[model samples]
Target chain A: MTDLNRRHVLGLAAAGLASTVFSPLSAFADEKELVIGGSIPLTGVFAFAGVAIEAGISDFVKITNEAGGVAGRKLRLAYEDTAYKVDQSVAVFNKLTTQNDIHLYYGDSTGFAKTINEELNRRGSILMAGASFGSELNNPEKYPFQFMAGPDYVEMIAILLEYIAKQQKGAKIVFVNSDTEFGRDPIEASVKRAKEMGLEVVGQIVTPPTAVDVSTEILKLRRANPDFTIFHGYVLAPLPEFLSQAKQLGLKSRFMGTFWSMDNSLWANVGAPADGYMGVMPYRYYYDTAPDAPILEKIRKLRPTYQATGYMQGFLTAMLMTEAAKRTLDAGKDLTAKNLKAALNTIKDFDTGGIIGVPISIPGNSVPVGRIYSYSAADKQMKPASDWISLKK
Target chain B: MRIATAKETYIADEGLLTTRTQRAWMIVLALVLVLAPFVLNAYWLYLACLVAINVASATGLNILTGYTGLVSLGQAAFMAVGAYAVAFLDGHLGTPFLLNIFAAGLVAAAVGVLVGVPSLRVKGLYLAIATIAASFILHFVFTNWVSVTGGMSGVNVAPARLFGIELASPFALYFVIVPITALMVLAAANLFRTRIGRAFIAIRDRDISAEVLGIPLLQYKLMSFALSSFYAGVAGGMWAYFFRVVTPESFPFATSIFFLAAVIVGGLGTILGPILGAAFMTLVPELLKYVVEWLGPVFPNAGAALSPVRTIVFGALIIFFLVFEPQGLAEIVRRIRRFFHLWPFKT
Candidate 1:
């Protein structure tokens, strides 16, 4: 406003941008707190999923504190929005991993994980998790410091293909997904597996996640006449519109999607058109109380606004990270990434109280299991259509 | 009110730092750029590095869009070319980072000429649309051209090595990035003093008049594009060194808008416009984060609302400047200087 104010703004611009690097060791000299940083896409196209994931993590932290914290130290998570951009996430990741001295971190996308992989390995002191269930970050050999909460997208696609193979012998399938690192992650394998299983891979529709018009995609599907259409790489909008449009056109393709597209809110929005929409979902739903998942009870109690599968993944991500931390400390080692990672690798058949399907394990940075679920128009829910499928030998 | 000192020679009058005050400011700015990495923490340094990179890219856009009157929406693509060039060279040849930076500019300049081909036939909004198409095509290339660009997974380069010292951290990168950016900005400012540069301004002011006066439109336009993309490429090379990774999404369409906004908000066609504009554009959202943090206690949902609110505020500020201060921050700064020079006399 004023010249002096302008000068002040310039000063702040030079000195105060991000303010991301803080020597956590210097701040928490008492060693009574364990800090974690996350770069979630809390305010972009993935805002809904981001917020839901935040709710899950927040509730998990709350429950951890209520249960007297991890290793008698308070667990805290500080995350910034990446807006699903790799650059923003990498910037945030650099800040958080470096001066923050955070024991753990969460990132936004597969791209961020890939970008930060070398840095994370070099640091090797901070464990990482986040939104992606794809990329080389899942390979512990590639990046030991990072891990996905579930099986990678390619594995999920394989599981879906396996399901389809069992359901029908010679089905024609078209893979429809958002054109992104996440969406395209499993496409190659999806096609190959379909061919390997003697299924006809008709056509692949790579549309933008925010595509409003499905007329072109519908026309393609109409031409190909696939018996099954599996969608991936989108959580919120495009699938619903496409599915509804396909139904309107009397296209008889059964729709399928991965975790992102397999959301209740997505199906709820699609309504009757999503009656038999299937998903290769990795985690149990927020309302899947038949299994009496304790994580759900904890989330329902702490964060009332939490819903959808992302929250469950978020909850699982936090719980898994903190559990490792708790185990590392209980193992009577210093609260370090090395110790926690050893604990993380040692995890096998560890119970999540069935809140997220059967007991899961992180053999090599990814939990290699997922379940297929179908949405019911009448019930307004996604019920498991197949039992748990695991990639682990 | 003021005394004008006549220059005895053309060189004295046409000098880059003609005034003692300008020389002093340059020294001070140099001191700040040099001393910044040591005093500031990594976060500030990281931001400073980003500002330097963005300022370089914005300066390139300013050359075309501001001085040449050619609106380009493909600056980010040009930058990507530069970045990937650096990444490819650094990854494969292990060439010296300095050579890589120049090669980046040269490669981007070649691509710039190709993209600027449309400028021969188009101008204004049509030109902008053509550039947008160019950018989309470039992005498509970055995505599907898996071998060179590393496909959708993106390419990673080791930390730039110079004398066995890796420019890995922001602290390490500051020394490399800042001087390069400063020199590039200097080269850009120096260009306006030359024939090609004057021709660019002529084309910008009125192309038909400039053509009648014997300036070739296509040649100068392509030169402007080449120069601008060269700057973008060098900046991109610096960015690759700073970030150490290059993805198709790294230089998204939003980035082109960011540079354009910087040139406009900094004062299009002016020397200091891109610098101030890039800094302002880069820092505003960060300042907004401070505002959101301050409001966190009162508004629980502030985190969820931060993005939209920041977007609104950013748009509002841009609109406010467009409506009220069309000449942008540079003009305001000039006015402030004039007011100070007048001191008590105006009152």
Candidate 2:
């Protein structure tokens, strides 16, 4: 009986100690502190995008801290590297939401966003903003917590197909993609979109994700002699190599890619060969003298060479989070995940301060349609191709 | 009578004891195993579950490499096969999770027989190379085959369920996995005592001599492969069900290396060695993570530095164990226990 009593006392002591440790920053505290989690690709295949997403969150935190923080308490941003691996990201997300008291999560990749959306919704985490422009993130009914900031890669492919049908006369389009999710996702959407747009998909080739020496595939492309070739790939290094090889092989194919393949680093890797290469971008480059905007200034401060793709992505996501937080505070709601999501839904016609040179807005459970921009190495800028084309419902 | 028999069996073995102190330690392990989930935080429970799965995998590898003297670098491929099989069956048939896991292992055992056919002709490094090739080829097929294997996009494994109860919760899931793993290990311990087990040891020691002794060396070696692959497959299925997702990247070439390293560092050719090795390898990282978290405030850039430092330290520990004590941590434990039991006894 004495031993039982002693064990009970010990258990109560442990519980008492836990309450003391957890109570200080508890949601029950007077001014609640919101915890935002980022499961980002800090290393691996898509490290570039991962680094950009994190910088964006850090800037958002800095801006919030400067502006008296969220509801007078600083927002705590906790990030874990997912390395662009899905299981690792899921594990990180589980840790953040289930174990730690984080309510908001920001994922880096399309796969990360899609995999964890259901889990986040089930757990009542409100806001999940990721740089992944996959259509899977846009469904309000399926994934309410997920709010994609920019145009998805599918929309970009559709826009690219539209341009190819109109601008390049008699151009037969051939899709060369890696044999992975990133490669296959756009292919499924674009094939249907291409049929709708009346562009001929001359050929389609699926290569390995880490494929080197694609001489065989390039030779196959040469035989197809398609004027427009869209290379849907993940790695930055290999796409340039593919381009250089294609040019040397005299394929005479005009190459473009999804957002990942559109970076200036491609041009730096293979200068003149990558001249006519173009891919769709959600926004203009940071150095573009497009218009007066606050985001441009922020971008410049973040990087000297504001032309880097990372700076632009970082600036855009940060702007979205900042706007969401401010609106939440204005609503007189605590900076909770639920309140933040409600604030995001209420946002409309907010400017990204000229960083994107395009006004950012969200209306009726959808990101405002993003305009397609094409990269030009001669001018070293991404000029607006056309106005924002609304995706068919 | 069983205890007496067990004591009598061990009495013939030198430098080993069946003392009261040893029995108490076993009882302590039993208590820890039962009470672990209650005391451990969710993070620890998750880590422990992973450790258990790794132990299961390492134990299987021990049967092939440790017991049968076959070095394999294709354990991950077998794991992938098992994972995909379970994933496919569960998605298609909605079979009970336990049945699906066993089915997956059985399917992998069939594949292991096919791979082991070549092992009859080859020996030593040649055998290792053949298995390593199997790992690479399987990894490639998993990555490229989109329709069946889900390609590189990966496959989502539905949460394991028994009857109507969801094993989605880590605690509930841990209970399910722990018992199954225990059963597998118990089965493995029983394996080494049988005629089939002795045939494996005989083949491992000298195939020609075993053949001369009228043991079907080919049949026994292939059976080792089948058993080893079956264990790996079951472990893989467990991993998939536990994580609720399986990607091609999840079972990589490096994972095969990890399994071999665990067995070598755990104590090859012994029953308890693989579990001991897996626990050490798996827990070391978790321990390092805890230490890093505790020391984060005091150390500059501790958060970023900790992961790389932990990885380096882990690698170093593996190398240290290999160089100094090739027999593994199991030997050290046995020694410590022996010293305590033999205290003040001159002989």
Candidate achieving the largest DockQ: 1
DockQ of each: 0.45, 0.19
Reference-based lDDT, each prediction: 0.83, 0.73
- A1-393 per-residue lDDT for model 1 (tens digits): 656776688687656543432323244434787777888887767777888888778878878888888888988877766677776676666555544558888888877787777777776677888888884666777777888888788888888888998899989999988877777888987798789889999999899756888788899999999999988887756777777888888988898888787888778766887889898888888777664576676566665653977888888898888888888888898766678888998898889866657878787888878999999999988989999888744
| Strongest candidate by TM-score | 1
Q: Taking the tens digit of each residue's C-alpha lDDT, what string does model 2 give over A79-194?
A: 66665665567666755564456656678776667566556655664577776776655677766777766666677787687677778655688998886666776787787778
TM-score, candidate 2, first chain: 0.82
Q: What CAPRI grade goes to candidate 1?
A: acceptable
Q: Weakest 10 consecutive residues, lDDT, candidate 1 chain B? A: B1-10
Please list the residue runs of candidate 2 whose C-alpha ends up more than 4 Å from where it truly belongs after superposition.
Answer: A1-31, A108-118, A134-138, A284-290, A302-308, A318-343, A361-392, B1-17, B132-155, B290-295, B298-310, B342-347
Worst 10 residues of 1 chain A by lDDT: A20-29
Clashing pairs in 2: A133-A152, A293-A353, A293-A354, A294-A353, A295-A353
Model 1 stretches astray by more than 4 angstroms: A1-30, A94-99, B1-6, B305-307
Model 2 lDDT, residue B46, Cα: 75
